[model samples]
Target: MDEFAALTERNRQLSKAMMQSVFELACDLSGLGPFPEQAAKARGTAPVNARLMQIQQLIEQLRADLQGLRGPYLMQQLQGLGVDQHSRALQLHIGSGPYVLDGWINLDVFPAQLSTNVLWGLPFVDGQCRYVFLSHLLEHLFYPTDAMALLQDIHRILEPGGVVRIVVPDIAQCIAAYQDGDTGFFRDRVEHWGAGDGQATRLEHFLAYAGAGPDPAWLFEAHKFGYDQETLIRALQRAGFKTILPSTYMASTHSALRVDEHSQIASAKHGDRHYSLFIEAIKE
Candidate 1:
């Protein structure tokens, strides 16, 4: 284990060096001055560049494989390929990750199972998915106009009666949890769950500020905006999704819709915080 740890540390340093060298080359290509420290610092800032995030995710997967841990994104990719442990039928999965949720195809811009543009190119989209799962994904898009247009494209891609399962952090829920007394507790929860680390706890409030770092608050700086339940419902309606009642939705719940234990670990019991939400909208 100690040898493994030593090797991991050594590899991390090597990876950083390789990444820095690449960045330096990019700067040279663009006629910029040396900024190795700045480049390294940029690597950690919020609103992580999509391309950089993809690279980081790939590295993390490689590290996981080296450490004999499950490669986080591999399951999603396998699920996209219909080789998942459960052997479930796969569909379209935009921005795949930790959850290789059943029925998602694991699409990204960098071309794994599928590739799309900033708005998920509608042209290459296979109009066959029963459900389009965007778990913790949409928050990274920068332009709402482009995003709405993409949503429209998504609307076009779904078969009749298909559903777009959208999961995102409920910003209003966080605000309410923070303001209705017990500010400190909710703040801590927001920091812990929102940023996925301890540093964000200190800058939680800055999330509301424009141009703040992505690592500071919210899931990503690319999280250009957020929504409350009402706004999200309204957005779905505008995008041609029939708003599903929680009871009815839960009643007809597909096997894929079951929330996992990890997803629920820090729910209301964990300091009255509001972290995430899943909404299903059927094309009517």
Candidate 2:
């Protein structure tokens, strides 16, 4: 396992042990006796309950402390910006991968000055943002529930007429190409799959690229779920977006909400223009 995986495992084990210890302490203090029918009949139960509440409060405070520790530097940067600056910002780019725009606050999980964990929830106030953009990000989340929650959170942070533009790999197109026996599709994208020569079959290359490989990078970038137009629209609708529509690259109903030209140029060069699906949803 990589260092990140090992560290995450260790943290999980520690959290489990700590929770168990806290539960045991609470049980011991509460006693093995059955509950009394009346509060007046109970002897010293009030003290036990009070102690348990105190312990629970301490645990909650510890949780807050841990959250602070997870992203102290990011938090400092955000705080320095102040609430007014964040609220006044018109656009946000979630998981922005090198496609920086002039007016948008670009955020990512990796090494960026504005790095943020979106699952922890956005820092902006409700109905504060005018636009949010995400490109090739939803599939990286390991669960549909998590993706839905993120969408709902995005919806919460957007203005009533705000829009969220999303771009993701088109699974329908991939499957269609595969079924049509398009060997070139697999062979051409082999570099994205992994470091292997011409030895591996096209099927193997396709599988590796689709995230069934042994590479740690594949594990990190693997698509948990692929989406076509319909499924993606359903997800957005479920998140309370009233208006959802399919969009083409670099084009949108709203001029201000168009996809970045750099992203369009990159997509065209990468030969995934037809392999990607773009969708925009309005918060109305």
Candidate 3:
């Protein structure tokens, strides 16, 4: 037990030292001058990126330690992410990952993933979301019209400076892939689902009244309509967002692409042909 405690302390110290070294090196590269002592009083803390990275590293090290110990490791990791707050009262949105890193509220009209149903209607929230994040959610809706209305509702719910961040698979990119004749094998994956305006229920949607079904053009089994970057950007502008970040090639932008190793591996294996567009819009 004493040896285990000593190893844990050693790992933590190593992580902290690595972070401090990286920060100082960054400061040097930027010609920031030894991270001025005066800056400490003026700025009050470290930059957000450095802190977030440190937290992530610490989590990784702790997870490794838990595995070495062999029991309750996953639970410890979940506790680190605050996953203990799961509740039936909350409506979970579909495709929501375990953590809400960017401070988005887990909400949906239907409880699918990690959301509590329709947070917009809740009395105390007062439409003050920091940002609304949707992961491949919009394409599943049948009524693009009602989906636009939902965005407007989101705008209404947000505080003045708050923004919405949406990420959806781009249909145009897939069509471009098909037209380019990349690979006959890949062409088989092109689905042609149609969008119809009705209360469509599918097993994945839990047979609940989903606003619309998948568009039949690109995805036959279950995709409604695929969106190109232009269509999505224009739609958000019409929905009353004051500022929409310019859409660019996801691979090119620093902030646009999440550069995690897992994302890189997945993209490489699957030929990232699907279009994923992200939008950041401020409420007017």
Tell me, by TM-score, which candidate is best. 2
What C-alpha lDDT do the candidate models reach, one value each? Answer: 0.55, 0.71, 0.48
Give model 1's clash tally.
6
Which runs of model 3 end up more than 4 angstroms from their true locations?
1-104, 108-125, 184-221, 247-274
Q: What's the best-to-worst order under TM-score?
A: 2, 1, 3
lDDT of 1 at 206: 36
Global lDDT of model 2: 0.71
Question: What TM-score does candidate 2 get on C-alpha atoms?
Answer: 0.68
Clashes (candidate 3) = 30
Q: Identify the superior model by TM-score, candidate 2 or candidate 3.
A: 2
Error of 3 at 126 (Å): 4.0
By lDDT, the best candidate is 2
TM-scores of all models? Answer: 0.54, 0.68, 0.45
lDDT of 1 by residue, 173-259 (tens): 656655665556555565454644444433365354222444322223346666566776776667777755332122236655443
> What does the lDDT read for residue 199 in candidate 3?
30
Give the Cα error of residue 217 in candidate 2, in Å: 7.7
Question: After superposition on all CA atoms, how large is the RMSD of candidate 1?
Answer: 10.7
- Candidate 2 lDDT over 77-107, as tens digits, reads 6765454534653688888777877667788
